[model samples]
Target chain A: MNAGIRLMTPVALLERFRPLFEPRGVVIAGASSHPGKFGFVAAHNLLAAGYRGEVFLTNREGGEILGRETLRSIEDVPAGAADLVFICTPPGAVPELLRTAARKGIRAAFMATAGYGELGEEGKLAERELATLCADLGIVLAGPNGQGIVSTPIDLCAQIVAPIPPRGHIAVASQSGGFVQAFLNYARKTGVGVSRAISAGNCAATAVEDYLEYFADDPETRVSLIYVEGLADGRVFFEKTRRAAAKKPLVVFKGGTTAGGQRAAASHTGALASDDRVFDGMCRQAGLTRATSIEEAFELAASFATHPLPRGPNVFVLTTAGGWGVVTADRISASRELRLMPLPADLRSAFDARLPPRWSRSNPADLAGSETRDTVVECLDLVASHPEVDAVVFLGLGIQSNLGDLERNGPFYPGHGLERVVEFHARQDTRYSELALELERRHRKPILIATELVDCQPENPGPATLRAAGSLAYPSSHRAIGALEHLWRRARRSTAA
Target chain B: MSAGAPPAPSRTLSEHESKQRIRAAGIATAPEMLAADVAGAIAASREIGFPVVVKLCGDGIAHKTERGLVRLGLADEAAVHRAATDLLAAARPADGPVGLLVARMIRGNRELIAGCLDDPTFGRCVMLGIGGVFAEALADVAFRLVPLSARDAHEMIDDLRTQAILGPFRGEPAIDRDAVATTLLALSRLAETSPEIVSVDLNPLVISDGRPLAVDALVEVRGR
Candidate 1:
């Protein structure tokens, strides 16, 4: 294995192969003083990101670029050093760069420029010549029309996009340049830190397969997300993804699934996405979680990173509110194959004795806001302590106010004042936070918390503490339930494997 | 998904012997004449009629298209007489005299392709698709491994992009699907049975109405 890694000389070799995930050094080959040149923008971003690796700028009129030495030719750079070379040169100049890189043993190259293979026969011939050169030298070249990679861990930003990603576990490999940029900025804003992001443009030499192999062993990457336009090699991709699933979760949002999209993908990448049914079967065999949208891809990966995989479908729902329990239960058991097991009779009787008779005795125990922090603590203790409920999803934190008198127009507390009513619902947030911490400390049943109060506002207590307390927090019960289901399936596959 | 193997032609054979194999298989081919003497060659050409194609039929030059050894549209008796003489002189070498296949020209608008490839993983598979350069350009081809069922044949045809071209378009009648399927199956069986056969190309499989005919054929084999 060491020999295999060593025979891959161009220090840029592996980075070129999976640059988005492991770009140690990135050089803009066609940097210029001209503002319009893509190389200028790309170099500016890499430097602005505080990249730690040696940065080189190559251009016709070589000079200082962001306090970095500019090399005029690839020959000037010592071989087996630079990990990634970005080709921001013109379309016609790429073939020469590829040949020069091959001679110098620069394996992985990102072609940020366009033209060739996409044009007519003349362009195809030029592209073919470059491909033949790479094959002969065993150098892996990325796209001539790609937006580059952004790795947060190494502080490597090869993209022209701003703000290098903050280090985290979610790794994204996308074929579309625009999508890659959008995902990175979104991850930063949403507090979902990204580990690595790759934009495999055109995939001339190195392909999605190379990235899959790299991420399989990537320790920083806990879960991988893919935005695929088309697959380069069907059989190799399927096999690699299958092996990858065993180690880390792989979530893919396969773009170009529609007819028009498929055509566009073919023209862009020179690939056939194949039939939809085949893709579905392939994903299933590979143990991949298919996300229908980009948001789901991010949400699913984020949830997986923070939470432990669930054991089974058995769940316990506890809420301070009434109607939310029904909504949570309905979403949890929406699948026909899944059944919502009722709370145990002994547990139900204990809850019934604590609350009024009309509080509704079923699963999703609705305490009707009469519960205190101690009430929440007791409820979570009992539910999580139960052998049947493998996981608990708690809704509505009671930390705000109203320690009691949850039921309005009820004689439980006659003539409850407005201050008392406000106090009753006021402190549930703090109480739920305490209960969430205690449950995690004791049972470790993987509790997922959400509340109606936290649905829109970002500053709810129960959701925040569920996250900090080593449990998952979500704005919606449906998201919490969906995340649980995903974890359950992943656990099933992992255990089976 | 292609099947079967094609039978090998062990050694170089005369044009007459090649025709005999096709005739034995109950298939019709164009007429051919190979006369030893000049007088006899001229007499044979006159008997065969005008507007015929002449070719240098030899052992080595199987890819005649690339060599430009073929002469087409020989109109008069004088044209045939002179062309045959020139071709015969070129065929004569230190080794031996090369025989020629004087065949009638079959004209058609449609060109189709059929071939047998011995897959390393899947064994012999026969392919059927659009003819000539269009097939290569469009890559509108489908393959079925030998010993295919009728359903498989239909599936392969439908899989092709030019499958619509095989159907009734404009005022023309639909091409016979059964005939194409049977040809694919037969090619598959042949390929599977004969490992010695390496490749086969039958281009311009002229189709009129429900009838399809293999007008031009080329076969390549392994070592002698």
Candidate 2:
């Protein structure tokens, strides 16, 4: 029961805000002269992004803003000046503002402020009054506490601030301001950009669930990521999430699992994080992948950006060192609930000829350390072509000690085989790049590379080769598993639909 | 021949009969008399107890909190007499009788709510939620189409925001899931079986130890 209840609300909030964000232009009432105010921030962002439609600003004694003129109230703003008015003022002013806005032909509002329904008794009355005003005037309000919104590339950054670089496939909606910004940074570094980033703060009038329905239809967004504290309606959210998952890759991060966290989350955002166990069951049934952290969230988003989703879970690890291969295989085996089969019988004999006798030639197909770039390429080709493996991971040795200076020393210290080792790595890097480019054309599967060294150079074939496949993050094996899991789910969802 | 059949009249009950019918349905009650005889009322209270809750319990006091017909925690015979006098004065029944009810004071940490309303379109519907301030503050409640199955009743108990309150949290014993389920089931059953009941409200159903005991209940029945 706990699990099911918590899972329902975030989805409900998302469903409620669908119409408010999709309008041609949303006006910010109480469009402030103050520098740090939400009204000022939202207006400045929208205008700078080249909003072509009407943007009417409202205040008590309306006049010119930074450049645009403000109306004497929502009533003074000419009818049809805007489709929606965003109230960034205090809750006390909201009822009157809503009353005036509704009279002047505004049909929707984004109440981007807190202190109502979240601040206890007095605030609750204020919230009820505001609801009454909306009901009377037939206005649709997005929030009494909301982070506003931003639709990328379309030049719609209604949020107080925009942290995303206006490009990418992933669209995100979060309850926390901090989580939303963190994801923006994470996506950029991972080479995955955002299509839209919004924070549905208190969801007084609209919720995250509303935007989800729009995102399900929005062609610009391919993968949808959600970070939630809670929702207003659980069953509505559950049904919508299930429907959205069928169309796009939907990944969610739900906070407030711990009792202390739930209490804090409630006080912070007025979100009731129902029960964790109930939420878990909902995610499973909806086919929505639940990410454990911010890192996993972005990694999963990134994985969906560049790779063809894996169908089932057969992963093959091909490497030059047995230890690296073993660790890579172990990570995948441990993290994924799927089966990782041994290499097929046909590829073994061909795999043996390229490596030295001392090489631990096993399922990972460890090409002897002394092997050249050609051997690495051959192993990948064999591994990728196999019938059993659905995904392939190549482990690259990206760093090697400089041997020129050491050659003067004894056999042990001298670049005894330093130059050869460096050359081997350099060749592997070049060959791997070519392999990555060639594999891109296949499109039937995805192959990723991992390495220990943080910096990969042209002189190092391993690093350069993997870099061609995609970007890399060091010491994030868990992130890698998250990536694979996302791709697998994304593919399965698309196929299942 | 079809036009010859007479239309049925709506059924309505006086306040005295409403309380009597509700008490007969396995619900507890305190001593009280609707008769204008002060002697009979005094006699009933003596048989009951010293401290008690007194209310006008009239059909007109729909929202008693606002109407000022409610007096709580009255102690001793003198206080009971004063409360009864105050309730009678507020009712302003100079012509004949005044309706009043005296109930035992119920104490508990948690307050839960159960309600049923007959929707003009959907027929009967039931609502269950955390009671008291949080119910209105959070709106953390669940609604079901009646008559609710055992699974539906359990889901309502499981889905609310403060569902943790139902379980033993913060050193409290787990709420009797069976009782909660039964209460919801009974409410649904009432809505289904008794078409005369227009709406029912059981606010602050106290959960002591593990069982939820309804201390206060009000039913709105249809009139003929």
Candidate 3:
């Protein structure tokens, strides 16, 4: 709340960037014949993503790249034929190439060229001139020195190296191109599918806020995930992200929330702000959930896409072991965003018939090891049936079934020892997880399941199938409770629209 | 927007003048009368009843309590006479015009803060926080962009870090949240429609008998 600062915003420049995200046709200005260059990889990524648009390639040598014939220059492409252009030329050559693309009526340009604004004073001057040129021609440029975009709606993957991810509801936009690669790597490792990923570098004309506003309107995107380094115009950033959060949850990994981190961000993305605490206040005002790490950001994203928002703050943890229930109950109690609801009389009565009398008749609803598969299913249904309970955290799913011990038991040790019996258990576990997913959909409340072992265990496909059905499984009850807390906190924010 | 002219700039508003703006916005302030003499102060105190506070009020006199110009708990006529003379003698206006203000001392259970400031990043923003001596040290406050809805105002009050202090504390009733929301929404409207004001700082908005009363306020004015 600093005074004497200009807070007027008569116009928001990040509006109407849909064509940048969902382009009709594209031209790669520097499609190189060499496989090592970025131009070649950019072209290859588009093809690998299964983009349906007519892709025109340009090279000075006038040859072919990936079986597509190349034009000697970009001017040869028909005017108004291509909606977007990827400038893969050097920094010095980008300005002239942008003029040619603008002359050809290209509406948006993704500049993969480096050394602009991020290098030094000379580069900054080049960036300033290029920024004016693009604005005058009414073209929204993504970057001057950056990585590229991965869009699922058009299958438009213009980035390098990282393969096209599956189409899902979470969209990502980051200031650091390298970190966007890391985000993709993390997404793949954690089974978090990305609908769109853009690493906007330098942001000469198109900024991180531009994609935020665009994704806010994208029907394919349910949660807009962001990694911001710095903002040239903080008001625009706050307004756009706030507007987007009103539509869906915004899981932000704001990189400069501390003094040391702000200094690093200035060196990294050239950000400027008086205090990071003011940014924190702005997030609260805008109703955004700020994540401390990339993993939390992804976890929040997956939770939003996979599960409906909880109706209230009360969540129930149903565990087979009393210890897991105690640990998860502690985690849930620690967060003000969520608390354990008392086991209602109806649920208590329902559990009395199925669960043994030794069951903990409290909020955690410990099953007390009397849970057969039938009892587990009934307990989950009971948890989902309650009106007072908002969400459920069920522990002891996969990897707890001891597949590794069956390996050590030489294939003939009783329940899951033989190969056929193990397969039967695996199939039954998969069906049980799928049933959990259906119950979640039927109740329209989040059911965050926890497993003791990592998913994709030796032969146990339970966790993987659960994850595939959008029932996210965490390795510990703490992480599961954390995810549920994030979900509930966002669900309770005022819809500031 | 009604009959009252917007507060004048080129100087800060006196406590009486500051309360006028908040009073015009549908909030409650204890009724009082200004007295220039000890005899007049005693009569005003009789009307305001016992447990009244006498203060030296004037332009640029924002911190009367720190200057020892404020005397609280003036229980009788004799005490009011002594307090009136002390405040009148200490009162000196650095800008122009000075006087003595005799007001009803509001009794309350808990203290809170409600305010409005123009933020560069989010434009006009309304704030609610745990107020008193530890307001700055704790820094436990929540803000929302102005032109707020009724829900936004309530959410600002609910977003405070010290929720335990606001509700049913020490065998007292909860702070009247609806009244707080009304006050905040009024300030938001004031900040939105009247550009002359820079900020409104109401510290220790005490929960007086299950109600929020602005006991002390300063409205900084910089004409638009």
Candidate 4:
């Protein structure tokens, strides 16, 4: 039905989205004095997150919220005072307020009001009226029952949510507001930065496809993460997602596959496509990586943000222990896209010359308890530069530091050269983390680092160092292998396209 | 079919009619002929070769094998005549002017299924899967939206879990992927052009000498 919107060019779509994502100023309509109301919380969050733009709040009864004075009506504000408006009023007041805001040159709106579309037939009719009005007014609408939007480039957190995430290159868009917040919370817990994020609640005026198309050409976004429950038009979603994937990696997680889940989705989004098999086929055809869970989706997006695309499927596994190597090799063998290549003679001989006599000189190249400070990085350089290897999964990062912990806690701590040894161990671990990123950039291949992160001490230098360098040390070998497989699939799809 | 007219009630087409429609779309089908009488059936079988298959065919007779109206491996003219006579006698009045279908009996080790359906969300979609008696039980299949490109056809074929069967299996050569892709592409075009066609099912597309031949098919159309 919205055929004209689909025909817009990517450049034009970017400009259309600019006022919503990069607005010069914003007006919070229906601003409340109560702390629990969304009207107050949205303004509080905008001010707390340090939004660097002119913000004007409006209430029917003029008052002061936080510190800014509220106007009696949106008409009291000057024309061109703000380009975006945040509506926290009831559903009945949204249409008239939007009309007034449009007259004042506000081209974008985000509605935090509920009680429409998700209620029933009457609610759906009301939702349709709002969509028609917004279309006629030439305004880009985000949601009628949505949470909010975040733009890190402008240091904007114009939402009713808490915890503005650190700035990075991964952009998130989801049909569920909870998922958008969950991804951002994970970003904060980890050190991954977010460029922009949105929760497309009810999606009455703007669908998830429009956001995907914008992210495709957004210079700040290197990867996009999406969580979808249903779609209004599967073909349009496929086309836009395919176009986006051709430029950068797009990771998707689909919900509502089972019968019970499908019923929930029908009520949740109002239009459900129930065939998971067809959805899987669409993913492969469109070159989008389908993640099985939320954690996997985030990890895949993180991998794309931090690492380079692997040139091929040939993977090399390097481990300090025999079991980690064996498990990693098994996982790679089970994968459809990755292959564990046999170690060539030249590379094997190079490892033999550098490593100790008891090394297990095979594909895994188990260190056999023989490792010095220079051993890991030297062996990594040898394999990563070789023509036979496309990616490397280096396991067991905190081995040396683990031993250092014991000596520091023991009786001889800092007594006879123990302090110097502990400091050297920590510095070496951090250096290793930084060097991995450098090697990945120099060789144009992915080098994933894995260590035990669960129940890990907060002061563990290996993972903390990786986080500081804007890289991730995967918690297990399986996760590392999974991220590497996604990189390889993206590279293959890019080549095919 | 007129655009403004209401759609007619949907019904199944006979096996022979379905094969004819698919063959016209550049898909290979088993060489067969329709006969009205026992003598005509015997002559058609002889022209096709010694060993053949015969079935009572009509629009109303959808499940012939289940109804015991199908005869397989008729090695001679006498067998074809007896089978044709018995099939004709076995048909009920509700079958409505049934005829005997005589065709060559082809043997193959590998079988694949290909078809199209009008999905509610994605419109027409082409499907490829492992086919045989266990097709429903195995449930190994992949799909793509209609109007498939050559690359899409190949990728859908590769998407199937039965990759071993696509290669050399049980003393047979590797299945002809190009031939399979051509069949899928043709079905895509047929689905795109024919709005009245509701669904097309080509089960057990038998691979004889590395080439897929549509030994049996059923096409559902919008009108009686």
Q: Highest lDDT among the candidates is held by which one?
A: 4
Q: Report the CA-based lDDT of candidate 1 relative to the real structure.
A: 0.67
TM-score of each: 0.61, 0.59, 0.86, 0.96
Report the lDDT tens digits of candidate 2 across residue range A1-497.
12322333534534433335455556778888667878788788778877556677776666677898877666677766566777788766777777776666677777778887678767767766776677677776666676666666556667676654546778888877667778877765444577777776766555666567667777678888888876655555666777777777788898887899889887877767755655654565466777888777776766665567776788777766577777767777765344456767677777767666765556666765757547766777877777777877766544332132233234654346666655554555666756755764474677766555433333344444444344443333345555776677567646654
User: Model 1: residues >4 Å from true position, as ranges?
Assistant: A1-24, A34-36, A67-69, A78-81, A98-107, A117-128, A349-358, A397-445, A451-455, A460-472, B2-224
Per-residue lDDT for A121-237 in model 4, tens only?
898889888899999998999887889999999888878886799898899998888888988987886678899999888889888878988998899899999989988777778
Instruction: List model 2 lDDT by residue over B1-224, tens digit each.
Output: 01112433433343455546545544333444553434545555666665666767654455566777677777776777887787677775532345666666555578788877643222356778888766788767776656677766776776676766777855658988888888788787777777678677776677766677666677777664
True lDDT of residue A429, candidate 3: 63
lDDT of 1 by residue, A245-317 (tens): 7778998888778899888887876665655544654565567888878877777887776666766778888
**Per-residue error (Å), model 3, residue A47:** 5.0
Provide the clashing-pair count of each candidate structure: 43, 25, 0, 0
Which 10-residue span in candidate 3 chain A carries the lowest summed lDDT? Answer: A1-10
Better of 1 and 3 by DockQ: 3
A30, model 1: CA deviation in Å? 1.6
Please report, as a residue range, the 10-residue window in candidate 1 chain A with the lowest summed lDDT. Answer: A1-10
**Per-model fnat list:** 0.00, 0.00, 0.17, 0.49
Q: Which residue pairs in candidate 3 have backbone atoms (N, alpha carbon, C) closer than 3 angstroms, thus clashing?
A: none
lDDT of 3 at B108: 72
Error at A157, model 1, angstroms: 1.8
Query: Which model, 1 or 4, shows the larger lDDT?
Result: 4
Per-candidate RMSD, Å: 15.8, 14.9, 5.2, 2.3
**Per-model lDDT:** 0.67, 0.66, 0.77, 0.87
> Would you list the rank order by TM-score, best first?
4, 3, 1, 2
